[model samples]
Target: MDDVTRQKILDQIPVIDYIPKENSQAFLYLKRVLHWQQTNSKNAVLVVDDSSAARSHISALLKRRNFTVVTANNGVIALEKLKEHKNIKMVITDLEMPEMNGITLTNEIRKKYTREQLAIIGISGATSGIHSARFIKNGADDFLRKPFCPEEFYCRITQNIESLNNIAKIQHAANTDYLTDLSNRRAFIHNANHRIAEYVKRKVSYCLAVLDVDYFKKVNDNYGHDAGDQILKVLALYMRKHFGGD
Candidate 1:
């Protein structure tokens, strides 16, 4: 290349500047946000694989992503771990294992915990599609073929956890009052109807009562919306303490 062309090309290259310590408020804020993301990525994960090397590798990867990891060598031990760690939100299990394989574990888990509460991902080295199909049909939320890339593994784990969190948030909003953090009218109606149906089916006696705050409108008018809200919250708390049940 000619000297003049080389000089022109070098001049056209963009120069990057590092942020100064005194003027790095935005950079600091970005760092905080990333830290928060890493901290809240996963609650806990159970890794079930017969191979010690594979379990170690998976646990290391999850720990790097700021996840609490517990491991089990077989499905039976995985169930025990699940019982011991009630906060485990996700499970990664190998399809082929000794003493209760992945499919049986998934089925047993589903009997107690729904997809909204727990996320299950099955991994297998077998190329047969039947294994994957069987896993999903038996209540596995996702399936991964073994020897997968680390990126794909983490991606699937993140997606499943996010999905479960979204479902929980939706259910909470549906069943809870926004202001008082108590059960809403819809929840009350649903539960009351269920109890009524069960009682009627069994020919049992039950009592129903309705209570309301007297002069609620006067309180709102005389005090203020804030005072009225406080009164409602107190009333809700009293009800919860005295009359709450399934």
Candidate 2:
């Protein structure tokens, strides 16, 4: 193909325009918003479809929006890709495929991955609402019908990803100490309850110890809060290094 023909075909591809060179105020504002989304998003998405053309189209759309995209021809292939790519946080899957259908795949994935670890969106050309409902019943986080508008597709993806990130943030805050980055009291209690049940059931011998720093308040009052924090951090690090578990 000639250069002009190639350029024309490239322009025909469905891609979002995120650049901010336009002069209009509204366009500039949109550009800024898109920039923020791009910078904040670092998620990898797995796209599973039996149709190569469909895979390419959706992958291009996701890439234009600053997401990392990996394509698999079917759910079996998608599962392998998931094992290989640990960074993948979301999956966009088609319901109809050979070897493994989307519903079956979604069910299998849910057995291993929780909603917090991986988000799944089901897409289908089926016009029936039953298809979307079944996808949700099979563990998909969201569903989109085929022939969807680009705007709607992006909105669904953004909403699901943002929800996952927010959940992770909340879980982190609940489980971790704000100052020491160690497991907080809540996490310790939760874990201890589980361990206690396991030990009682198995009759395993185990021991727990609680440590308190001597004159910690004096250290804070004399050396300052920063020094007290450093001392606590050092103790936590030493404990982690010496008593870490698998």
Which of the numbered candidates is closest to the native, going by highest lDDT? 2
Q: List, in order, the clash count of every candidate structure.
A: 0, 0
Q: Global CA lDDT of candidate 2, please? A: 0.85
Cα lDDT computed for each candidate against the true fold: 0.83, 0.85
Residue-level error in angstroms, candidate 2, position 117: 1.7
Model 2 compared with the native: what TM-score?
0.73
Model 2, poorest ten-residue lDDT window? 13-22
Residue 186, candidate 1: Cα error in Å is 3.8
Q: Give the per-residue lDDT of model 1 (tens digit) for 87-199.
A: 89999999889998999999998998999999999999998989889999999999999897665776687688778878989998999999888878999899889989999
Q: How close is candidate 1 to the true structure, as a TM-score?
A: 0.71
Error of 1 at 201 (Å): 16
- Angstrom error at residue 195, model 1: 10
C-alpha lDDT of candidate 1 relative to the true structure: 0.83
Task: Report the lDDT of model 2 for residue 68.
Answer: 83
